[model samples]
Target: MLMKANEPVGSGQTGLSDSEAASLYRLMTWLSPSFPVGAFSYSSGIEWAVEAGDIVDATSLRHWLASMLADGAGLCDGIFLAQTHRAASSGDDVLLAEVAELASAFATSRERHLETTAQGRAFIEIARAAWNSPPLDRLIAVCEVAIVYPVAVGLVSAAHATPLAPTVHAFLHAVVSNWISAGARLVPLGQTDSQRLLVELEPVVSATATRALKASLDDLGSATFRADLASMRHEAQYTRLFRS
Candidate 1:
């Protein structure tokens, strides 16, 4: 298994039924919206598109979020996490650079940039000040000054010795939930409707993981064009409620 020397023996090895209650608690704490990462700020282009009359009601918003999740953001961020996890695991510098460059280029709009990179930078700042894991701290130096989101998140999870699947799971789910939360406020969708929307988006993340596992490097720059355009428009909106 090659875990760190201090790694605690687990039921998985001894079958003594010691649950990973500590790790699970850590995952829950990281995924909570109260982590102070500003995850609730950016809408990932949904605010703009909805304001532009592109998404009107619950049905349309669900379909829109579904499409974005299935074919757009979810698949892309999953890839980032996969690569980031790999880099963090092997302590690969070149892989880390690729992760950052990919994140910088993956953005299609200012809002997307704000959404991912800004969050990335925040993740690094908070991590350095609080948890202060070596791999995460090393990433702050070796990597470019702009710390990408998934990379920082990956390092924290890896340092905490969290499983890749659940870490990725929490990250993807958080991303989708933020969009749905914003949509509820923006389109005035009922609270129940937003809850239903999150329930539906779960599979989108799973399907995205499937496709991400098979995706090629050539597919990196691709994104939904109208969605990007709407994001650009939202920046100059006469009345602004959201940053994006």
Candidate 2:
């Protein structure tokens, strides 16, 4: 198995281990909506898309999200999360901190900035209280800029020794799930349709994660320009169902 010089020696290897149950449980807990990241309150501009008739149904919602997961914030956040996990697992605080800062600075719009940082702060605060570790504590102490959600997820998962690939996969899945939930409400999609959409997106999520594993900061870029405009417009939306 070839490995990058900076990659953790045992990285990308996990499953059915003695700690498998614990690892799965942790990922589920952290990614679940109940984790208090306030994920439900932000749609990443999906609310505006719905308002603009850009996502009036399951098909449109899926189309928009497929692009998001493949090219937009999804790809960028995936790489950030992947790198942060590798750095944290390898005990490279400097690299972890660098990734954290970059992720925070990479937000393109005002709401996008708020969307990530708010969730990041909440994730860190709750994780610190419940899943505290020296590594996490050190990350908090040294991270001058507010951590972004992906970076925070990476740090927490890596510090817990959760495998990188699954962690990124679960985190991205959770992101899509949350967005779907928003669409279901905003697009008024039926519960069954939402579930179906999620099923369809499984392949996209897997492919995005696979790409992210080999990607770096240089790979961070977004092509979801309309969504970006929607996010900016959402800030001034007369009546809104979501924060972003």
Candidate 3:
């Protein structure tokens, strides 16, 4: 039988409720690298950074990504996702539309735009097919333009009744992990280093998500100019493995 959203899925007292467990599962699946969003195909300009010698090792990689999460696309995208989730959950189509428009225009470079929107379009297509809901339908109808990656994720998470906090954290975690993966391959780091980077980023991911939840649309901004330039430079890069 289909479990109601409020019903418990497991018997243990320490276990998550049905809705919580379902939300967790969905978030994990959606944010997983195996998801069909093609996230692994884009390095978010990490490739260019590596090539430019901005990231020569795991330590450098962590520093670069730390700035990104705190002052760049990572934080900006988090705010966008948080706003999108709030707008979506509140049934505020006008606000949702505004957020979506701003997010689409917020891309710093051509390849960056392509990177986000491509994954976004793919995310929405796959999600609608697999997890269709009325809210998702309304979100699509309201936002006529190309949805950005964060907006797509926020909208889908809200549609599924997933809480914003975990959704934001998971989304950011996936982004950080993807960047680390790119760094690992480019820098030729071992499995241990990559895993270590992820572990070290746990606090950063938490702090970012916390700030995102409290942030308003006015908080949307990025200070990571080098990272932005890397994305632009990636376009003309002679040898490239990533789309951005």
Candidate 4:
């Protein structure tokens, strides 16, 4: 069953079990900035937003990221992750392949496509080396095409038996955190402001994950036109610090 927005994940009436704890550990490790998916190298167009003066201060930064989480890539990626997790958990290879194809085709820009697929490939290769499993291997075989970021994460998490709620939550959190990191540098905000932004985004992340868990594939769409435009404009940005 899907977890509620406010429910504790990886815990029961007895609290966290060893297996649950292990799953949490794996999630943390895989989603960590240091996990080597090259997440730090991409700002998801936050750099362009900063350059365009769309995110000039903490308030603007918060609003921009909130929109992204609620209406843009953050929400879309969460839905893909949820769908992929469900398909993998059910051993539905057809559904899994379909999700993979849709996700790969979902990118709004060229750099966006590169950002997701490059990270997805790196994630699968690293996970296979460190956390190999039959399901993970099977996912690689069935998908065949270049996997997108969210699908790769969902597949790996399911292969290791991590629950869907926490996996989706962590994935969104990591994405938001990466964006904040970019803003911190581009906006030249202090560490406190960056941390404060992260704290403020917690509710958005939780709500996004919950919505994604309930979303159907037909619901997949992005309304953040400015954000998409930002991504496209970033490609032509002469002074760029991020890959996307």
Candidate 5:
């Protein structure tokens, strides 16, 4: 998995000189829900789905999550993360700003925008203060306007010189894990069942990451209208547990 520092952007290389253990640890730490991004408070619309009976059981939950990874915000965010990494790696602050702006405006609704921006703001603040890095700082300076969560993460990973494929995979995995956690609480799923569902989605996660790794921003699109509508509806959800 080792790749040279000079490899093409998004080449998915684990740099030859990069410490594999350190890279893994950094990815784990940043992606953990405990990272203070407040990821636990948002459901990414999963709460609305579960309440609407769209995701009632493990099977339904897996199906919904797969859809999200394949054709929804998951795909969009992966592109932002990958593109931002490449731009930040080359110190192209211009491109970084563009990606960040696009990600911010790409949100389909108020809840969706809040979900990305709030978490994004929190991520940059924490990463800058605690896990400071040159690349991360450059990203911040470049995107003076705003920094989306995926873009912030991409900047950090690229600064650390981590491989793109693994970074994106870990990012998406954390996302899915967070959503699963939400599902477990909202649906009151058993711990064993939650783990089982996660296991079942591993293949989907890998495939989504691979697809996003190879995808260009031109490929950005989503067919998950239900999810989008659910998020919009969540804004008015009479009794909701998640923020989005």
Candidate 6:
């Protein structure tokens, strides 16, 4: 249960007590690692950091995760998540396209593109086919390349019937988990170390969740310089395991 820096957990008192809570629990369960968002395959920036020797072990992995949380995923993902929700609710193809383009252009590695975009595209389709959501389906049709991560997240949120904050929180949690998983595999960290990192990151995730509420596109920026460079470099790498 990683908590963003300042995010408050759901009150557990939405008055729906039994059935509603059960449904939400089910939704969260499905959206976890087993959800077909293709999340497990990508290291985001972790793959690149490991390749460049910047992240060689547990300590370095923690350092990289902290920097990424502060610089990129914390803000960029939140902003994109908001955009997806907006486009889906409004049924605006133009806006969705704009978001997709913006996100696609941000990718520096082929793996990054495939990792994020592939999921984004499939996500739109899943929402359309499974939920029969007209707005989301249409949004998918227009998004061919990497769908923006946030936008895909928003669509998933809508499909799950979870509100904005929970949806966003779930996303942040997934990122922390994914990065930890990547670190565990790439840096050969023990399961205990990975879990510890997740626990340590709870406050950061909680804090970021709250700060994310006030963030917009203008505030989206990344300070992980080497990570970004490694992603660019991975596109041409002769061999690699994880996507960017």
- Which portions of model 2 miss their true places by more than 4 Å? 1-15
lDDT for 210 in candidate 1 is 65
Better of 3 and 6 by TM-score: 3
| lDDT of candidate 2 over 1-244, digit per residue (tens) | 6878897655246545568878998999999989998999999999888888898889999999999999998889999999988887787778877888888888988999999999988998999899887777876666678899998898888778889989989989999999899999997988999999999999999999999999988888999999889999999988998999
Compute the lDDT for candidate 1: 0.74
Clashing residue pairs in candidate 3 are none
Please give the RMSD to the true structure for each candidate, in Å: 5.9, 7.6, 4.6, 6.1, 6.5, 6.9
Instruction: Write the residue-wise lDDT of candidate 6 on 1-244 in tens digits.
Output: 7779787556563566564675467457545787677777777767767777999988788877777776765557766776666666667768777776776776655666677777666655655566564545555677666566666777666545556776667778887898899779887889899989998888887777766766766777788777777767776666677766
TM-score-better candidate, 1 vs 6: 1
State, as a TM-score between 0 and 1, how close model 2 is to the true structure: 0.91
Angstrom error of the Cα, residue 137, model 5: value is 1.9
lDDT by residue for model 5 (1-244), tens: 7768886655254454348777888888999878999999999999999889999988899899999988898888999999989988887878888888888889988998899889888988887888777656756778866677898789888888887888999999998999899999988799999999889999988988888889988999999999999999999999988889
Please give the lDDT score at residue 145 for candidate 4: 78
Clashing pairs in 1: none
lDDT of 1 by residue, 1-244 (tens): 5888898877677653333565677677776787778888877778877777889998888888787777777777767776777677788878777776776677777777777777887776776787767766665565664655776777677666677777777787777888888889999888899888888777887777666655655555445677778777888888767777
Give the number of colliding residue pairs in candidate 3: 0
Off by over 4 Å in 1: 1-19, 213-221
Candidate 4 per-residue lDDT, tens place, 194-243, comes to 99999999999999999999999999998999999999999999999999
Q: For each candidate, what TM-score against the reference?
A: 0.86, 0.91, 0.94, 0.93, 0.90, 0.80
Q: What is candidate 3's CA lDDT for residue 64?
A: 95
Stretches > 4 Å off in candidate 4 = 1-14
What does the lDDT come to for candidate 3?
0.93
> Candidate 6 — worst ten consecutive residues by lDDT sum?
130-139
Off by over 4 Å in 3: 1-12
Query: What is the alpha-carbon lDDT for the whole of candidate 5?
Result: 0.87
List clash counts for every candidate, in order: 0, 0, 0, 0, 1, 17
**How far is 132's C-alpha from truth in model 5 (Å)?**
1.9
